[model samples]
Target: MLTDVRKTDRLNLMDQRGLRTSTWNVLTPNAPASKNLLSEELRKNKVSITGLTETRLTGCGEERIGNSDSLLWSGGSTRRNGVDLALNSLARKALLLHEAVSDRLMKARFGHKHGKMTVIVCYAPTSNSGDVTKEDFYSALSRCLATVLPP
Candidate 1:
């Protein structure tokens, strides 16, 4: 049910037998030129939805050119550090979302539309330069998201 694909080929076979929609997650760029690379890929694959994490989004203005997706976010109460869930402009749903910046959970949800569901993407901080610290952060993140996950 889970697979990690190599970035070279740019080909992915989807299992849409029972699934009506798909959400592909990627480490987004803060650059404008990168849009061409993904725009082509998206058009080719017919990817319906997306859940991008680690997207160095410095602005919340949502003035992108290539894709005019209405991005929704639960901003980190502080300043520039936060997460945004950019829905492909076509997705029609009243998004149910929340972000806990001081804590480990950062989530976004889009429920029920064209028989589709949402995937919560979290940006948990890496505790420190050491592995032990990173491990601790991962554990805490797991526990945090666990509370909001569907049972």
Candidate 2:
């Protein structure tokens, strides 16, 4: 018997050395109190980097959160389907490049000894979403993936 492995399957099992990464749907972390709480949770879990969805933070920008932790966020003009990438002090130092692709997609590049690693944070459309919305997300994701440097 033969098994077929997809790209996502490979990504799920890829080794990241000692890097600790995670994803979370935070509902709405628009308030300072909520952001502080989220920072605490990340610290308690020992997560070096995290991808946040539904942040509900309008516009694109970067901010300092809880000492040295950095928060880079991208959102639509109206604050819907936002995405963000948070990195601790250590991980922030290795960041090479990052871009706010859209409200639903964000891309970051990190430097390693061997090569660069691309981390794409995306909030994909749900099954109930319209076809056009889903298609746009995938299309944008494809373009982002195509631009990643070889590792």
Candidate 3:
């Protein structure tokens, strides 16, 4: 079983191997304090790229979190179903494209010397949501993926 300690160790191993990526469901990232806390956690974990779900942030844009971290988020006016991608300095420097597909989905592309990496952050509808809503969310996600052609 992968306990918390094992998870941390595994992540550290991945970092040592130069594979620094992570994901989190932050639930709400609209506040500066929350963003700061998340940034600190990412730095502590030595994660270069992170996908965040349910950010609850409105509008769509790119914002610098700290001196070396950046966030790309997408959300609607209702303060719900937002997604984001956070990138450390190294990943930010390699950032080639970012798209706010919808309140439920966001995409980011980073160009490395070896090739390109595409990351998608998504929030699917909860079970409480209606069937139509769930279907729409999946359909939107599909469209977003379809549009992101390979480099």
- Which model scores highest in lDDT? 2
Whichever of 1 and 3 has more TM-score, that candidate is 3
RMSD of each: 10.3, 9.0, 9.2
TM-scores, all candidates, are: 0.49, 0.86, 0.84
Distance from true position, residue 72, model 1, in Å?
5.2
Indicate the TM-score of model 2.
0.86
Descending-TM-score candidate ranking: 2, 3, 1
Q: How accurate is candidate 3 locally (lDDT)?
A: 0.76
1-151: candidate 1 lDDT, tens digit per residue = 1111122221122235222243434445456665555545544555444444555554343334255444443333334334544444344233444343322234544444242233555565555448875676588667656655552
What lDDT tens digits, residue by residue, belong to model 3 across residues 1-151? 0001111111122233485888898889867598778888989998888988888888887788876798888889888878888888777767766778889888776666556667788888999999999999999888888977675
Q: Model 2 clash pairs?
A: none
Each prediction's number of clashing residue pairs: 0, 0, 0
Q: Between candidates 1 and 2, name the one with more favorable TM-score.
A: 2
> Which residue segments of model 1 deviate by more than 4 Å?
1-28, 36-40, 58-67, 71-84, 92-94, 98-105, 113-118, 122-129, 149-151
lDDT of 2 by residue, 1-151 (tens): 1111112111211246466899999987877687777778888898888999998888888888887788989999997899998888766767766888999999887765556678899999999999999999999999989988787
